[model samples]
Target chain A: GAGVSQSPSNKVTEKGKDVELRCDPISGHTALYWYRQSLGQGLEFLIYFQGNSAPDKSGLPSDRFSAERTGGSVSTLTIQRTQQEDSAVYLCASSLLLAGGLDTQYFGPGTRLTVL
Target chain B: AQRVTQPEKLLSVFKGAPVELKCNYSYSGSPELFWYVQYSRQRLQLLLRHISRESIKGFTADLNKGETSFHLKKPFAQEEDSAMYYCALSGLANFNKFYFGSGTKLNVKP
Candidate 1:
């Protein structure tokens, strides 16, 4: 079975540009998540989607960051007006379920974004 | 405020020697703990979880609520075990939001 997959392994853009990173979660997985890994920093939660309910956007760092999961499978994280601080590896993960259950999240290769 | 802590950023051990990676977490409610590992050029993957009570690759972790720790331990270290290990915590009430540690890079020398 294919694990979580992400597109555009690497991306480079100038400051103030907008970029979107894509993620294809494992088939049948009901949960999707996005995280950012800055240099020498731990993985920071970004957003989460489960089934068809409202997503948990508490982890999103700023208003410039937004994510959406369509058809409950594919997810996209968009960073508007990119900043030098946004340079990091954007990671996506998925799990079978997350609501009051024990699940392990499988991660994708990640998209390394560089904002110059 | 849920948080996971990995005090050591890097740990070096010799082949065939015992290995221990310390992890501490802070959360008010009951928490589910997990250990994630990423080998060189590999994506992060779950190594083990506290709920499963199973060991993978000779590694085991005992969750201690009293001490608020879930340290990964192995009797003998293998060169293949060298990688980056992250300690993560998920709150019981929250929707499986994982808070990861700073991660520990393990180096095993033969």
Candidate 2:
């Protein structure tokens, strides 16, 4: 079984540019999540999607940080007008359960984004 | 407010020595706790969960509601155990959205 996977293992962009990071969750996993891993910041939850319900964007640091899960499998995190502060590893995860059940979250290899 | 804390950023232990990684959490309601691990060049993966009440790879954690802690421990550390560990919490109040700790990097010397 394929685990959660993120594309563009590494991405380097200029400040003010927009970058899109992709994530492919495990098949049949209804819950998808995005996180940011940075130095001294740990893992910060950016957004979450469960099935068709609205996403939990409370953890998103700013309006520039946005994510979308299409067809309930693939997700994309887009950082608009990227800033130096946005330089971090973007991680994605998926769980087997739905409806708020506590399940193991399989993580992706992460996309290392650098805003130079 | 829901939060997970890992006081130590780094912990070093010798092979065959006992190891403990402390974790504390703050949440208004009952929270499900989990320990995730990441080895070098590996993605983060589940090491254990409080609900499962089981041990994996010679590691175990006891969740204490009274003390608000869930620390991972092992009787004897192995060099292969060296990696990053993260403590995470999820509860109904936050709709099961996990709040993760800053993570602790463990170094086991042989």
Indicate which candidate wins on DockQ.
Answer: 1
Runs of candidate 2 exceeding 4 Å displacement: A98-100, B92-95
Please report how far candidate 2 places residue B1 from its true position, in Å.
2.3
- For model 2, how does the per-residue alpha-carbon lDDT over A1-116 read when each residue is reduced to its tens digit? 88888999999999999999999999988888889999776798888888745456778899998888879789999999999999999999998774546467899999999999
Backbone clash count, each prediction separately: 0, 0
Number of the top-ranking candidate, with TM-score as the measure: 1
Candidate 1: residue A81 lDDT (0-100): 100
TM-score for candidate 2: 0.95
lDDT tens digits by residue: candidate 2, B44-84: 99999988889899999999999999999999999999999
DockQ of 2: 0.67
* Alpha-carbon lDDT of model 2: 0.90
